[model samples]
Structure formats: structure tokens, C-alpha cells
Target: MSFLQPIALLGIALAATPILIHLLNLMRHRRESWAAMMFLIKAKENSSRMSKIRRWLTLLFRTLAICALSILLSRPMASDESSLINFSNQKPEVLMLVIDRSSSMQKKFLGSSKTLLRRGLEEFEQFSKSWPESKLVVIETVFSETVILDEIETLFSREMEDFFGPTDSGGNLPFTINKGLNWLEDAEIGHVQILVISDQQESNWKIRENEQLIRNIKDKIDSKEGLWKLRFLKLESAEINNFSLVCKTYREETDKFHPTLLITGNQKNTQSLAVKINVNGKLSNLKCRFFPPSTTWTPAISLSDQPPKGWIKISLPEDSFSKDNDYFFTYGNQEMLKVGIACKDEHTRKFITAVCNLDPERIFLNETFSLKSKKLKENDLLMIQGFSSPEEDSQILKFIKAGGRVVNFPDFDGNNKPQTFQNWNAIESASKNDFFQISEWNRNQGIFANTANGRELALPYLKILQRKIPKEGETLAFYKDGESFFRRKTIGQGVVYSFSTLPNRDWSNLGEGFVLVPLLIRIFDESSESPALKLLECGESASLEYNELTPITGNPNQKPSVNAGIYKELGKFFAFNRKTSESQDEMLNQEEMKKTMSSNHILWSEARANSLSFERAEIWNLFLIIMLLFLLGEGLLGLPAANFSFGAKRQ
Candidate 1:
């Protein structure tokens, strides 16, 4: 038993007050030895013992009443299954079950072979059986669709198996619950008991991001306080040792293709594991080690140039979750990178062309055309100085969506009215004898990142004499004055990188080629290689523009949007992997749950990985009834003895 208001239990001390008052009454009286009193005392002596028994009974009832009142105020709850059965005498009209069926639910329970989703389903099945009269309604996370089961036995039918099966997608608890609430209002459900079963993964809940939705749910539940009851069954266990693998980036060389992999885990000590590498049907193994205190490991694999266009599959030994253990990748035919220049300034165009032709063997300067030309789609990377009209903006945006990278510099002609992307503000000139210097940049994983051998770039030493500020985007590098030096925005499968200053001596020291060469070369390589191979999150394949997608690995019948594997569409292969957010280990704690729910009347319980049955039901009403009965008994026992005497004189 648990008390919602445990502090009220302190009132139980008031029960002793009845005994204290009775003793005080006895002390107030003194024995009188008068002869007239002796006769009356002797006449009542035979019935005095019976009167003493009645007085004690009345005191007992008063003490019980006080104790019952204290317990009632405390709001005691019964947690066992049997106790729940007796407490829920008044059954609900509807039993609504909300289940979280994300990939994390497939994790095994501690010390048990069954997964959290399996345990939750068994518990809900038993609960539905307990309330046979109530209609059963289920809301699953994958689709957030409500399924009404007319017969409780149909829950285990073959038709329902697919609905409860595992999914590769992540769960959205707030959205699913909101959908359930809307259904309740639309169906006009009365007297509902909502049971939410989940592992309470924090990423799935997104409590902070969905505050307004939670508030709306609280308001609707508050309006139907008596008609609705909310219960949460949290399935949780200690963090298990697990590893996740992903393909961060890959580079193509003359003789081989190198694929860079990132491995992350929760182990506290150094460990080594073998990874299986499959290159176009040929399998091989490689070993990698992870050091303590650092949970990330990056390993690169080299494949010969024999098969220019094929696929690669990297797999790790199964750990806690098998879904994230394997990563898929595909490569396409190699070709020279095409660079497009769209600038009105002669110096800027020559400078960019010089940079692109530095490695003439691998780079090709296709053309210097206007932004409105259809040839924009023919190049892999576009260097644009300004947008002259909305048509140019639409053409550039279309190029970006079709997997073309763009680098935008301030307009020398001062025409900056781009409709799709961020536009540049007026150019700002530096003060005399001072220049703008870069202070911070994201060097972890962007074009400004460290060199291949892990050497930092010379961005801190670069200075700018004049610059323009981008309106808005993700700022990758910041200037000393807190202005954006470099910003990036993602569109479709491609990216646009905006630089505040030009690459000439008049603008800044970027003409020295220290930062300009590597930055432009990296963007060029990324644009040339990234489009040939694509890595997407699960459930995102449905948005592909291809008319048909055929599975290349895993179950051939499973749709690419519902599973992780390699699929071919329009002669190109795309790899689908689980969302990185599912690998997070954080969960909702008790304090967070209380603050988000904001209702003390709700009942919640936690179930261990092995232990099965758990439920909470408020028994405060039972205590209230007991208290009333005790008070009634006390009143009857406190009445005078003459009230029970017969009316003999009237007869």
C-alpha cells in the first residue's frame, strides 16, 4: 500500500484523544460515602458491569473513526492485482491502451528473455480479461491509429499480429496520446480508464518540446476528472552494454574507395570486437578496439576499384539491439567532378575557377553560366555570387534538391532578393587598422573540420576587411564580433554553404589560399560523392521520388519505409538505417513525470523486468465508508440505557 498524501498519517495520533477524555472524566468524580448514596450504589451495582462494557465499546468505535479519517485523508492505494480486482467494483465503460512500439521496445528485459513490449502486451491482455464488460481500444505508436477490438479474444488473433509487431521507426508519445484524446472527444467516450504502457524513453516522450500538447491534454482530462482515470505502466531496467554503428563519411580514391565508420557504445572499459564487411557479396572480417572513457570509435575500410558501382554491408556482433548493429552503403560509377561558376565579378570567377582547376585530373570547370540556365543541374557544385530574380532562386533551389551543393558569396552588384534561401544583408566595412577575425567554428564534422590526418585548420588566423551577414541558418563558424562567418542549410539530400566574405585581397586574407583551398576542395569532393550513395533514416524512404523501389537485402516483401536495408530505385541504391535518436539511453524520471502530468489523482506503477503483475487503485473511498460506519456505531453505543427500555406503563 502507498499513500498519495503520506503526511496526513500523522493525524492518527488523534485516536488517543478518546481514551484521554474518558480517563479525565473518571478522575473528576470522587467516591461519596453518604447513607442515601449507599442505597443507590447498591441498587445499580448489578448492571454497572454491563454499563462499563458499553462505554468501552463506544470508546473503541471513536478511536477507529479517527484512524479511518486519517487514512482516508492520506489517500491510501492498493498495488497488488487481487487488491485492484476488489477495488474496481465499478467498472469503466471503456479501456483504452496506448502502447509504445518503437525499436527500443525490442530490448530484452533485465534477467528475462521477454522484451518490454511483450511483457506490456501480456499485462494488458490480463487486464482486459479482468474487465470483460469494458470495450478495449488500442493506440499503437507506429501509425498512431486506433483499433477497437469488439471481442477481447481477438487481441491475439492472426489479424492483429502485424499491428503489434516490432517497427524500425521511433515513437512519438505526446503525439500518440494527443491522438487518443482527440478520439475520445470525437467518439464521446464516457467513463474511460486509459492505460499507457511504455519503456518511457526520453526521446520518445519529448516532454520539453511538447509542453503545449501536454497542457492541452491536462486540461481535457481535468474537465473529465471523474469520468476518466490515467494509469502508466513503466517498463524499465538498468542500462545495458550496447554498441551502435553508423557510416559517417566515405571517400573515393584512384585505386580504392575508403568508407569511414563510427561506433558508439556505453561500455566503461576498453573492448575489442570483430566487424563483418561485405563488399558486393564477398565477406571479410576486421577487428577494432574501443578505449575507456570514450564511447566513439571511427574505423575506415578500403575496397578495391574492381567493382566501381556496388554495395557494402558492415555488421557488428549482436549486442542489446540487433536493429542498429548493421549499416548499409552503396557506391556508384566514378566520374570527374563538374564545377559551375555563376558570378558577375571577373576576379571572383577567375579565383573560383583557379581553385577548381588546381587538381585538373579530378576536377572539371564545366561552364560559367547565368543562375537561370537549365545547365545548372548538369554540374555537381555551383558557386553563385548573387540572385538576380525569383526565377534564378527557383532554379538554384531545384538544383540543390536534386543533390547539388552550392556556395553563396555576397553580391557585388547588390541584388539580393532570393525567395527560397537566406539573403545577404548590406556589406559592412571594417574600421581602419582593424579586421574581423574568426573566433569559433564547428571543426568536428563539416568542411571546416580538421584535415584527414587530424590537423586543425588555419581558420583562426584568417582576417576579413569587409563582410555581409546572412539572414538566418545554422551558423558553423562565427566572427570575433559574434557575426556569422560561415552558415549552412540542408535542402533535400544536398547542402548550401554561405560565406560572409569574398576570396580576394580586397575582401580579406582568404586570397592567400590557406582556408580557401581546403574549404572549396572538401565541398567539391562532398558534392561529387554524396549523391552517388545515400543514407537515410527509416520510414523516410516513402518520400523518395522514384516510382518503384525493389528490396536488395533483408526480407524482399518488406517495404523500405518500414525496415532497414538496401533498396534499388531508378538504377540507384539507397540504404535505410534506424534513427540515431533511438540509440539514446535517457528515460523519464519520476520528478519529470509528475511535473509533466500535473495531476495527483493519477495512479502509476513500475514493473521490474522479471516481475509481471502490478497495478494501483485508490482505496480512499473504502476508508471513508469505514469511518462513517465507525461513527454510527459510536452514536448507538453512546445513547442512554433508558432509550432501550420498554414502555411498560402504557401497556
Candidate 2:
């Protein structure tokens, strides 16, 4: 047992004076007698002893109340003293808070109340304020890892303020928690209290070791006089349904644009869902039935018409928390992705150059010499006109991964291998229509105005190269006829587009004028511009605006194994990750994460129940104390009550 203020014991010394005075009065009255009232004195004598006993009991009760009140004021408590210190107002205490800041937290599940974080943070803040001068250490966990946010003994310190920011929204949250536990070994204090505030979605990570580790930590803290607290907040959407346009891709192989969308319907109806989309300001409604009942849906919508400044949105009905419902993504400007065609044949070079439209500077036609792969920046999109198999080239794969598009056009002069895609019989018989060519009407009626009477444009396709494409997702476009005319597949976290046909009209006339510009532009520019905070997609990732993490093993020139993941080497691309990828793997995009997270957003208040584990013994001990007090009271009054009953019966 310990008290916040031990000096309050002086009150106990003062309590003794009253009891001493009462004893003196009783002794002085023992020899006093008056003969004038013998009969009256005899009558009062019987009740006098009873009255004195009652007075003593009343005084004792009053004294007990004063002592109890004083102790409560001093805040006496029993807890571990593992973290002892010599500082003023400081007892032994350890408090650890685990905060989840994954991208999903972007959803305001707390209604218009407090945010998940705001609620936990406020509890800690208020507790610290009351304690005033006590030690506090904080650890932030996301995706099974922990970052020591800050530690302080003073309530509102600068370190505490600086440490508050967006949570890490990533893969396998248990790992983040494990990281936090391991890092906590550095705590300079002894007694510790572990508090976890999150959605409690670790069932998928139900490893026995993890479960045991959590219990072990709690037992240590409890044994040493520390507390364990857990506040779980469910992330089910309550008042709002949101739709996000995650990402767009261009399969240079197929010469098509594929856009992915993530929709969440947390409405009263858990059956079916529907959503509407807007592309470059053009609107269309899409519906999903409970025939495939699901709470969340990920759908890919293809655009037939190439909107110059591609703007797209997927939206559900708006709610008071409007940031999540409707999302906007701008397809980067519709411009030709410059291509460098390397071939020795002049005719093949000219044909490939004519198939694209960009500033003359973006076009490189050559029967020329070698180019250093590294210097080939910005306009790195390349097409090998000759029938060369780049299957062995990992560098080309890296190019596509970096967002640079690539197209391989076979040479018509007999040097190129057309058979690499598929048989010619397949190309001769296939469905040739634009993305909007559903229900017989060409969706690009206005955009393809120049070629209303002509056949569909030529999109070079190829049989998917297995090694070049990672097994991340599905293959969106396939071959036409026999040999694959055009195909799009993701490669090593990059995109690869392949075309099996030549660029000249010798194969197809779709390469005519305006269609060529839009087609070429679609393949080169795969993503949208800087979008509003609310328009971010689910698996789509936005990186920090500043350098935070970097890789060492891959980039040869950089220094090895940095202690803190920060450095100039982190370059510019570190702040991007997809919370919406099909795999649900975590990405590290914290730069643009919001900092002004507030509490008035979470619904459940922690002033009620915020405990991780409860010891049965402590509770039973409290009950035993109350029972013992009851028995002592009975013993103190047992004789008097018996005598009163006997006297009443005789009367």
C-alpha cells in the first residue's frame, strides 16, 4: 500500500488528542457523587453506562470516516514498485500506450464523436495532468511494429507534442505490436502499465507465441505493481459508406488503361451494394447485388474514351463524415509517353515513330549506337522494333516497375518474331471493340469521331511472359485471335505492356491519326496527379512529402544498414504504399498523413471500462475485507443488543 502524499500522516497524530480527552473525562467522573438526588441518580445510573457506550461507538465511527477520507484524498493504491525513483510526487509507475495508425483509421468509425486515437490520448493526458509530476513513456504500434513516440515526467512536454502523428497503416499489425514489446525493454523505469488501443483485429494473427508474450509482459508489470489496460475500438463503418478510386494502370503490351476502385458499404443493408463513377466528368452508375453478398467490394472500371486530364471518382451517399464516401483521382495529363525505338531497320523505325504523338523531343528513331540505361531517365519508355525476346532482361522489368511504360513492336521486315505471341489464326478471329463497346454502341462515339466507319484500332498484344510478370494480380487483357495481339501484366511491383503486332498499316489501320495519340498517351501515363486527402484510394498509397525511410541492400552506392530509417538516400519515392492492394500488404506512406487528429471523433468513452486483464484475487480480497468489517461491527454490539431484548421482554 502506497499514498500519493505520505505527509498526510500528520493527520493521524492529530486524531489521538480527541480520544485522550474522552478517556480523561471518564476517569475524572469515576469518584463524583451527589446525595440530594439519590432516587433520580439511581434511575439515571442504569442508562448512563449504555449512553457512554453509545457515545464511544459514535466517536469511533466519526474518527474512522475522517481517516478514510484523508486516505482516499492521498490516493493510496497497491501496484508494482518495479520502477522506483527519488523524484518528488513520484511513486513507482510505468504506463505504455499502443496506438494503431493504419490507413484504415482513415475511416471515422467513432461517428462524430472522438477518433480512435483521440480517445486514448485524452485519457493518458488527463491522467498525467492529475499526477502532475510522474514519469510517462509512449510507444506507437502499427503493422506489428513500434516506435517510441516520446517519454516524459512532466505533463505537457514538447517531446510529447512532437511525437503525435498519423499511425502506421500496414500489414500484419501483430508484428508491429511485437516490435513495441521488444523495444520497451529500454524503459529506464521499473513498474509498467501496458495499454493497447486499437480495433482488436488480431484473430488472423492468432499465434500462440504472441498470445503468450502479451500475458508474460502483463504478469511482470502486475507482479512489480503495474497495471494493464486495453481499449478496443471496432472499425466497422457506422454512419457512412465510402468509395475510393485507388489506382490506374497502362498495359503497354495491350495499350489499354485499367483503373481499380475500392467501395465500402457500411449501411443498414448488409446485403448488396451499388456505386456510381465519374471519368473526366462523365458519370455512370454501377450496381452490385447480394447475389454476391459482401460488405466491401473491389471493382475495376475501364474507360473507352481517353479523357485528356483523366478525372475519375467512385462515390457513395455522403454522411456527416464526408471525407471517406466520395473519392477523386486525376489521371495524369493525357500526353504521349516518349518511346525510344532501337532497331537497325529504317522502315521499322519510321513506322514505330509515326504510331506515337508527343513533342518531337520525346520521339527517338534510330539505326544507332548504344545508350546507357541509367542516363535514360524521364522519357524512359522504350520499344524494341525488331523481334527480340527481352525475356532475359531484368532491367526492362525494373523500368516498368518504376512507372515507365514499355511496348515491343515486331519488325515487319522478317527479322522480328511474330510467332512469340500466338498463332495467326487467333488474330484473324476475335472481338475487336473499345472498352465502352458494350451493348453494340461504341462507347467512344465522340472521341473516335475521326474513325467512325473504320475497324477498331490496332493494339499490339502478346502471350503473357510469365517471368516478366509478378504473381501479384490477374492478367486484365489477353491475346486476340491466335497470337496475343496486346496484353497487360504487372511485373516486379511495376507494369509491363506487350504488343505482338507491327505498328504500320501492314497489320491494321487503327494506327491512323488521333487514335494513335490517345492510345499512346494511355500506355505512358498510368497514375493520377496529387489528389485531395479524401480522394485517396484504399490500396492506393500516398507517400510522405519528405524523406523518412530508405533501402540499402538494393542501391549499391548508398551506405549500408542505417540505424534510423531516415537519410537523403530515402530519395523521393519512400512515402508511397497501397492499403488497397489485393494482397493487403502494408505500405509506408506517412509524409502526407494528417497530423491534426482530434478526439471529438471517437464514440465509446474510456472513462467507463479500459482494462486489459483483471486479477481475481484482488477482487476477492476486497470482498473479504468488507465481510470482516461486518463481523467486527456485530461483535462490538452483540452484548448490548442481547441485554436490550431481554429487558424489553421482562417489561
Candidate 3:
């Protein structure tokens, strides 16, 4: 037996109190053999012996009663075998049904047309009906509103059907359990029985230990004193084969927009798949093949010369689950890069102008401006040819905070001071003889990410005439003397790149090397667009910064709504769908789940097509009953023998 309140067992020492008292009573009496009245003494001794034996029996009963009471107060719970003990007299005080309405639950398995969620709910209904007096609380998902069932007949109604309807949102098992714990805390109930019905997908159930979410659940249940029983009814299928489509990206080639779709599945050999596109109220089909057992095939659809003016809907072949089969996309015209040069020096201006207006493939539209120019847009890249003071013009810092990138180059005019938010610090200038060579560099990131033949190509064999030591940020390129050559700092939505030396030959040989062209282009690209893709899961909220667009299918712009589809917001597009990781068919078995959850109060059952079951049974109340029986026995033993015989005829 496990004791919930092990500290209460210390009261068992009180059982020795009855034995000690009985011994003291015996000590108080003395055996005196007097010959004055022999017959009287003998008769008295016999009566005294009988009285002493009765007192001893009563003491034993009281001690046993005390021990039983201590055990009961300690809240002793029986071992695993106690589940076999039938407690039909006891009823669940709180019945909680936590259902998973993720997209994966809609998969129809063999031998049944109903979805996994449907079958699981039907099994729960059957079990709940057996205990008609149970108070039910339904939690569909972590995001779902908590519902209290008023009537038993309402379990299978149309309203409940919608509550358990299909959804494209993914499920977080730990978060759902936390919600249930919150409800259980406020509920004024006795014994709680929570039924969690889910497909038990590994992506959802395999909560990481470091997450602290599952830890909260374990701690809450452990502290409940075994008042609640958590049962997971894992629904499984016979065969697992699924396919999904992911909207990857949009690429414009030859002035035409093409939408790329990544088709992924676990088919055995090769399977033919259909790609459907609905545009201008006309439907078109394209065929593709999946070379399987885990293969990804990417196919692109080129739009016509006119392009799609309205929202476009693309769909793949329908499978058992259609939540992730469709995608939405809208094409906006290509945006141009705006560049602002803050350099007034004629020599520096000439170099910057030559780089910005390079050829027929010209990308950046350049304009000359001061640091306080009103023409500077938030998205424009402000390239300062010489060092600028953040204190001289507060507008420079304000422009950066408003989503503007700054590229600062050293002018060596002795007016240089470290910016407030920039990570680097200004130190003593390098000596003339102490020229530093390239030591370390982060070639795989930032501006040098795609440098051609980066590993084989050697950096310019040049020495810095003067440079400053960087105090922070990633050292993209370092000098042999432990000074940073180039550093990148991220502040809010914008970035600042600091070069240790000037761009001209007088300070460094970087401009004469192959790094200049790609460096400028990468900076322009970073300024024009965000590098991160805005892929979202269903039911997630859009950020306030992005311009919300209306979906074509429904009025998704309604207040307080979570709808899934493609959306074009401001400079980027959002492709929201079910998380691709949740599509894996892997699941945790019963034993595996027990170890993962690490809670003794948890019970698990696999409610297959035939039967439903509950595993763990509580035995705390049984200990209480045993204690009461012991008390009754002590009461009967404490009564005198003459009192019991008074009811009978006097003999």
C-alpha cells in the first residue's frame, strides 16, 4: 500500500498508549494472600481474575482500532492488483472528456466508416451512460471552450457533433492537460475521472521533458492526493498511409509567377496523384507521381500571361484526410528595392553609384540623402559612407527602429564614436606596422553565405592600415590580431552591419576583391524583403504588423475567428495549414506512454472496435470503511458481560 499522507502514520505510535495504560492499571493492584477469610478471598480472586482478563481484551480492541484509524487517516492506497476490487457503490464525482479534434483524427481506418474521433466519442458515450449520474465536462482541444453537459441525451446531438467536428489545427497534449487541470482545480467535486480520447500521435503526445508544460501536469496530478483518475483512450488504425501538400514558395521567372507545391507521402512504390487548380471559375487537372515509402516531389504551376488577379486555390488528390490537401496563394506585383546613400564624399559617392546602377539586371533604385532626410522610407537601406553619430541626429536611430537597415563604413575622420544600440565598441586605432590578416570568419552566414567557391577562394592578401575592435555581435570576419573585420547586429526588425575599415584601398583591399558585389546585393536583398517564411498552423492569430487580407472561401475577417487558408499580408504571404510534423503515423504504445507521462495516477486503455475499458481503481475509501468496522468492534468489546446478558432471562 502507498500512503498519500505518510506523515499521518506517526499517529500509530498512539496504539502503544492503550497497552501502557493497561499495564499501569495492573501495577496499581497487589495480590495479598490473607487467611482471615479464606473462602471469601478465593471468591474475590476469581472475580478479580475475570475482570482483569476482560480489561485486557478491551485494551487489545482499542489498540487495534487506533492503528486502523491511523492507517485510514494516512490515506493508504492499495497496490496495482486493487483494480480488481469492485467499487460499484462509488461513483465518479467529476467526469471530464478531453477530446482531440486535430486533422489526423479524421482518418478513416479499416472496418469502419466513422472517423477515429467519432468512434472514440461513441465509446465514451457508452461508458458515461453506464454511470447516468456523472457530471460531464467536455474539452475538445486546448483552444476549445470548456463545456458542461446538462443532459445525458445531449451527448450525441447535432450541436455536440459540431463540437467534435474536423479541424486543420494541430494539438498540443501538454497544453490540453494544463487546461483540464485548471478546470479540475475550480471544480467542487469528490472523485474525478478524466477520459482523454485521442489518436495519440507521437508528434502530439511525445512531450519533451524540458518543455515544463508536461511537468506542470505531472506536478498537479501528483499533488491531487489520488482524487482524480486520468484515462487515455488511444484510438488506432490497422494500416497507416497518408499524403499531404505543402505550399512552399513563389518564384517569378521570365516575368511569370509560378507556385511551387511540395507533395509528400509514404506510398510503397510509385503512385499517380492529381493536381487540381481552380481559376476564373474553370478547373484544370495535372498528373504527378510519388516515388514512395517517404518521398517528396515538388511541382510548380506557371500562371498565364495575365496572371491571377484574384485569390487562387490549388488542391491535390483527396485522401482519407483532406485538411492539408488544399493550398491558397495570391500574386502581387514584384516590388522594387529603394536605396538611400548618406555619403557626401565625391569619391565614396562615385563607388556607391557605380555599384547601385550596375546593368540591365539593375535592382536597387538609389537616392542621395543626409542622415536626417525626410525622403528616407522605413524599408529603405541607408548606407552611410562615413561614420555617423547617433547623438547628432536622433532620426537615424528612429529610422532604424522603424524597420530600416544601416550599413556603416569607417571614414577614419576622428569623429567616430560607438552607436548606442550597436554591439561594437571603439578602441585605439591599430599601429602602422601592425597590419592584421584574416583570421576567422562566419562564411556560412550573413553576406558571405553564397560566396562563389568560398572554401577554395582565398580572401584578399591585404592588411588593414587601421581598424577597431568589436565588443559584441557575431564576428563574421576577424583579423589575425583578434580584431573583428566585419560584424552584424540585429536590433528590433532591422540590422546594422559594421565594417572595421573603410571600403577604399587606403584602409582595406575588400572593395578590390570579389566580396564587394555579393555584399552589396545581399544587403539590398535583406532590406527589400524578410528572409523568414510566414508559415502558420491553423487557428493561429496573424500579427498586427501584417495587413490582413480577406480569404476567398468565407468571411474569415470576422472578429474573433480562426480560419485556415492562404492569405497575402503586406510584403509577404501566409500559407497556414496543419503542422506537417503532426502528419507522421507513428504512435506511442501503452507501456511507452506510461513511462513518458511519469505519473502513477494515469490510466491507459486502447478502446478498439470491440470493447471499451477503464484500468485503474481507487481504494482509499475502503481503508476508511475498515477503520469504522474496527471502531465498532472496539465498542462492542468495551461493554460489560452483565449488560449483554441483561436482555436474556436471569439464570
Candidate 4:
């Protein structure tokens, strides 16, 4: 607690204030002869007033002295930390860079030579050259518009690796920069710098917390005598039209593709663009279509030849973010999604097994399956002819949770004794109106638009006397009256699809249809969407990929990354397949939701919605200012009560 001045404590000698007043209670003066008495009384009154003034001055001086003393003891300070800590001389600063590859960055003002990121990186490189041994810590951002996870070596230096290309087409403009700055914890003072190279898109740059964190770090560095510089390399060019594809996916169960293609650009209206698709590197098809900007275009993609290879690519012949004009992904193979059915009983299991093919080894027969975490490997759709036992029911639920899928017929026949497992009783309906079916209208739909050898479905006739829908039932096949024939629901991650009618000739003849295999394959495809599946609808710009085998890679923790090529036809709107990731058993707490739902999940969804909204911090600051104003108003209101009442309002 060193102080600039220690002598200020001497002012405490004035603390005798009130004591001095009491010690010398002056005797009241008596008037003597006329003139002398009057003068003496007046002198005494003057002395009394003077003493009162001295007492107040003494009290004020003592208080001031105490405050000064505290100040002297406290040793109030401003830090030289920022500079002193930088004492140990260091080499050039290393920066981790994230450059923007948005189409806007590609706008050319002078000529083809300069684009946003190109220029920004150039400036960054130049800046680094000025410092000795200044290294790049880590740099990974889409350039030219493609998302690339740089090999670890790429973080070293250009001499260590040389990989440069335009970035992929999509990056949500707003960023989460915490991942960038967090790595520099306790680095050599002034030895590291975070250089995020971007064009400073207004949408991306306004994260106040990011700025505050940087400022705090700078302040701390200053206190430690360390050098901290927030160097901004603003890269900009004239904004231009940007048409990007946001999303694309295929529904295997339906043998269909539904892509939500988004286009954002200067041109708000629809424009004709050619979409080129290659199936497994083989040139497949090219079509011209009109796409409107800033809207989702659900497009249908079909192949006339062998179904587009698992790997598909879509390209827009033109767009600024050209590096990402196409994307590639392989859908689960139809063969991989089938379950070979081989059940025990003739009345229950045998009958259902015939409904769809499942192997004895792969079948969901008993409870031991999921204790091992082996979700029923419904490489294909599961076919359960008979109702499962208590053990089977529990296993089925676990399988569903583990991602096994099944389409089954629940037997509730009077002739066929229904199966009962603990909580669920499969009761057959004798009512003539009980049977529900998938009408011919649904069967004949042009669902396989792009498939060359696509299945032409024939309805299955399953009249198994079955139980009513469960509380968690899903009506996949419904009757005209809206009752379910096929009630599919999740038992966990596994899918439990039940049908009331049996599969054999005695029941409805649906099991012996040409479409049976195809329909079953479709179910498997639908269920496998449980992990890393992409969906796209009709009229949407979609890219198809056939990179590998069935069973899309299920890396739950590995970031689900989609590479949309230079155009909007590629992987877009890389939405993390949320349904697959969330726990089916985890219910959204409505009480918690209600607290937020008054504003319609405003804060919850507003974050991902990418909608333009006011910053909450600014709102809170305004609230603080309002509170301060209120206090100021209260203080002002009291001014009128004082002796110096603000000149009374003219009566």
C-alpha cells in the first residue's frame, strides 16, 4: 500500500470538532451601561456563530483526512503489467487464421487478380513477414468456398504443406470464435496473436462478447506488461450476387430424394441454371431449372439408369463460390438394410417371418441382442410375423434405441391367438371394419421418379387379427376410416412397425406381392436415416454422391460436415440430423419451455434461425441506463423538499 504522499494524516489534528464545542460553553453576556451592554451582547453572538463554523470545518477536514489516509494505505494502481511481462524478448507472433470464403468475398473490383480472401491472406502474409520467426498457429477455413479440415501438418507452414483451393459454398456467416481464442491460454506474453482473416461481413463481425473477451485479454496483458494487439485486417470488395445450395437428401425407403436448395444472391428473382449431376464419377444427367433466391427449393432427383451410385454430385455451372459447386455422399445400400426373417412358431413367428425376409442369425428373436448393444442389424427392413414375447419386446425397444428398424404384422386373430408380452396385449379385432390398408392411390404414386429399374409396388394383403394402436403408435398404413394397419413407432432407437393382418394366404395376401421386397427396402432406408442421413424433396437442387458402401458413417462425435461444392447443388444447410442425435426418451421439459415459449422459443431458436434481431447485450445496457435514469429522477425529485426548493412553481 505505497502512497504518493504520507503527510496527509496530519490533517487528523482537526478531529477535536464536537469536543471543542462542548468544552468552552461560553457564558451568556449581561448588559452593563446602555452602549457597552449592547456592544458586548453583539460580540458574543458573533463569536458563537464563528465557533459553529469552525466546528463544521473541523469535521469536514477530519473526514477528508480519513479518506486520504485510506487512499495512501490502499495504494490505488494502474498496471504496467502489459509492458513489464513482455520483458523477456520473444520472436514474431503466431496467428491462427480463419478466412471467409463467402461468394461476396469473390466480387472483383479491379480485375480477376483480387478477391476477398485472396487479398486478406496476402495482407496477413505480408504482416507476418515483418516479425521474426512469426509462425501460423493453426489455420482452417473454407477458401474459394469448400470446407477443408487441414491435415495437422498444414498448421506448420507453407513449406511444410501446400494446399490451397476455393472454399465450399456455405458457412453460416455468424461464427463461434471461442474455439479459436481458447487455444492461446497462457502463451508466451506477446508471443501469439489471433489473426482471423475475413472480409468483416457485418453479419459475422458483430459478436460483442468476442470483442469484450479480446479487450479483457488485452487489459490483462497490459497489467502484466505484455503486448496484446487486436489487429483487424478488413478485406472487402463490392458485394455481388450469391446463389448457394443450402441442403440436399434422399429418402431410401421411398426411393426418393428431397433436397431443400437455397439460393441467396443480389438477384432476388428466379434464374435459370443448369444442374449437372454425376453418379459415381459417371456423367449421368444435366437439367436446367429456375431457382428463386433466399428460398428453399425442394427438388426431386431420380436416375434413369442403375439407381444413382451411392456417391452423387451436383454442380451449378456458375456461381462465385465455385470451389463448392458440387457435393458427394452415398446413401445406404438397399441390400444392407434388409433383415432375414427366420422365426420359431408356425402360428406366430413362422407366419410373420414369411411377411419379409430375415436371416435367423440377424433376426430380432430374443432379448440378448441389445445387452450387447448390437442393435438389430436390420441391414434391410425387419419382418416380424408373430407378436414378440416379453423378452423380445424389451429387446425390440432396445434395438430401436440402438437403431434397428423393423416393419412387422402384429397377430390379433380369434383363429390366431394373439401374443401377449407384459404391458402390451395383441388383441385381434373381429369387427369387419377393423382391417386398415394402404390404398391403391398411395401405391400407384410416381414415387420412383428417377429410378430406371424402380419397383412397381403391388399391395400386400395382411388380415392378421391385431391389437389397437399403442399410445406411442405411428400410422404408416391407414384404412379409409383412418385406423392403422401398419403402426410404426420407436421402442428406443429401433423401429417397431406393426400390422394387424397376417402375411400368409389365410391372412391378407399383401406378403406375396411384387412390391413387398421394394417396400421393405424402403422401410430400412427410412429407419437408417437415424444416423447421418440427408433429405431433399421435389424441385430442389440436389447433389448425389456414391463414395463408399452402405451405412452412412455414424460418427456421432465427429462433426457432421457436408461439402457443398462451388454451386448450390452440393451439400448445403449441413443440418446436424437432430432427430438421430437427441435421446428419444428425453422429453422437452414443457415447464422450462413455457418460460421461454411466451415469446415463441425466441431466444432458443433465434440463435440457429439466423434471423436478424437486436443484440440482447444492448437491450440489457439500455435497461441499466433506464435504471440509472430512475435513480437520477428520484434524486432530482428530492431537490424540491430541501431549503433551496427549486423556485416554487408560479402559483
- Best candidate according to TM-score: 1
What does candidate 3's lDDT look like per residue over 1-651, in tens digits? 345677899999999998898789889999887788777866577567887777677777788778878877877654332332554335677688888877778777435778887787776775665355778888876365678888755666865554656666667676777788787787756777788888888667634322477677777777876777777887876464567776434445543446645566767778787788765335778787766643344445555654434345678777766766776654543456567777744556667667788732535545545565565563467777555666534666676666677777655565546666454455345466776677666443346552332342244465666565545454577677666777776565566787776656666566564666567766665555432233445643332233255444544552112345655545444545565555566675657557766777887767666544432334567767776776777677677665243436676
- The residue-level lDDT of candidate 1 at 148 comes to 91
**What tens-digit string does per-residue lDDT give for candidate 1 at 171-200?**
778788889989999999888888788888
Q: Estimate each model's TM-score.
A: 0.62, 0.41, 0.52, 0.37
Off by over 4 Å in 1: 1-237, 253-255, 268-272, 293-308, 345-351, 412-418, 423-495, 504-519, 529-532, 541-548, 569-572, 580-614, 618-651
Better model by lDDT: candidate 1 vs candidate 3: 1
lDDT of 2 by residue, 219-336 (tens): 4334433233323333332344433223333221122334433343334454444567766557777774522212334455565666433445566545444434444443433333
Q: Sort the candidates on TM-score, descending order.
A: 1, 3, 2, 4
Worst 10 residues of 4 by lDDT: 577-586
- TM-score-wise, the better of 2 and 3 is 3
lDDT of 4 by residue, 263-369 (tens): 33456567677677665446645454554434434556654444433555566667654533444445433233335453432654554444334544223334222
lDDT values for all models: 0.75, 0.40, 0.63, 0.41
Per-residue error for 256 in candidate 3, Å, reads 3.6
lDDT of 4 at 325: 43
Question: Which lDDT value does model 2 have at 331?
Answer: 43
RMSD (Cα, Å) of candidate 4?
A: 16.9
